[model samples]
Target: MMYISRRERFSAAHKLWNYEFSDEKNIEIYDKCANANFHGHNYELIVTLRGEIDKSTGYVFDLKKLSEILNQRVINKLDHKNLNLDVDFLKDLIPTAENIAFAIWNEIEAELKTANCQLHKIKLIETENNFVEYYGQMQS
Candidate 1:
C-alpha cells in the first residue's frame, strides 16, 4: 500500500485542569498548564493515509481532496478557537496533544473510509518539542 500525508496548522487555547481534582493537585500535575487563564499553541497536524494507488490517477489519494477534508473536518473546528470551550468533539476530553490526535482521528476516519482511504496516523505538534501520534488504537 502507498501512503500519503497532509499537514495543516491551527492556533488554539487550552488549560489542563481537571474539575474533579483540587486546584493544588491540578497545579502539581500540570504546572503552568493548569493556569486558569489558559495558554495558546500554534499546532501542526499531519494526517497520513494508506491505500492502493488508483491506476487511472496514479495516486493513493488526491492531495487536494485530502487537504480539503483536513480543513473542513479538523482545522475549521480548531483554528483560533478555545479547545476547552469552543470545540464540540473535544468538550469532554482534556485538551492534551495525545487526546487531540485521537479526537482528530475520530473526526475524519469515516470520511476517509468513504473515499477508499485508510487513516494511518495522526501526528499533533503542540510546540517545538511536544507532539503526539495516534494510530487509532484503543486505550486499555
Candidate 2:
C-alpha cells in the first residue's frame, strides 16, 4: 500500500475555555489559549490517503479530484471561521488541535471513500511547535 498527502492552509481563531470551569481554573488548564477574546493560527493541514495505485491511472488518487473534495468538504467550511461559534461541525467541541484534526477527518472521510481512497491520517499544524495527528478510527 502507498500513501498520498495533500497540504492546505487556512486561518482560524478559537479560545479554549470550558464554561463549567471557573475562569481561573480554565486559565490554569488552557493557559494563554483560554483568553477571553481569542487567538488565531495560520494552520497547515495535511490529509493523507492510503490505497493501492490504480493500474490504469498510475495514481493512488487523482490530485485534481482529491483537491476539489478537500476544498469543498474541509477548507471552505473551516477557513477564517471561528471554530467555537461559526462552524457547525465543530459546535460544542473545544477547538484544540486534537479536536480540530478529528473533526477535519470526519468532514472529509466519506468523500475519500467514494473516490476509492481511505483517510489514513490528519496532521494539523497549529503552530511551529504544536500539532496533532488523528487517525479516523480508534485503535485497540
Candidate 3:
C-alpha cells in the first residue's frame, strides 16, 4: 500500500481544567496546562492515508481533494477557534494533544472513506516539545 500525507496548521486556545475537579487538583494534574486564562498553540497537523494508486489518475488520492477535505472538516473548525468554547466537535472533550488527534480523525474519517482512502494516522504537534499521534482504534 502507498501512503500519502498532508500537513495543515491551526491556532487554537484551551485550558486543561476539569470542572469536576477543584482548582488545586486541576493544577496538580495538568500543571501549566491548567492555567485559568487558557493557553494557545500553533498546531501542526499531519494526516496520512493509505491506498493503492488509481490507475487512471496515477494517484493514491488527489492531494488537492485531500487538502480540501482537511480544510472543510478540520482546519476550518479549529483555526482561530477556542477548543474549550468555540468548537462543536470538541465540546465536553479535553483539548489535550492526544484527544485532539483522535477528534480530528473522527472529523475526517468518513470523508476519507468515501474517497476510498484508509486513514492511516493523525499526528498533532502542539508545541516543539509536545505532540500526539493517533491511529484509529480497531474494532473487535
Top candidate by TM-score: 3
lDDT by candidate, in order shown:
0.91, 0.89, 0.91
TM-score against native, each model = 0.95, 0.94, 0.96
Quote the lDDT for 23 in model 2. Answer: 88
Task: Order the candidates by TM-score, highest first.
Answer: 3, 1, 2
- Which residue pairs show backbone clashes in model 2? none
For model 2 the local lDDT of residue 92 reads 88
**Per-residue lDDT value at 74 in model 3:** 90
- Candidate 1 accuracy as lDDT: 0.91
Candidate 1 residue pairs in backbone clash: none
Output the lDDT of residue 128, model 1: 99
List the lowest-lDDT window of 10 residues for candidate 3.
Answer: 109-118
RMSD of each: 1.9, 1.4, 1.2
What ranges in model 1 sit over 4 Å off? 114-116, 138-140
lDDT of 2: 0.89
| Predicted candidate 3 versus true structure: per-residue lDDT over 29-137, tens digit per residue | 9999998899999999999999888888998888899999999989999999989999999998989898889888999998888355689999999999988999899
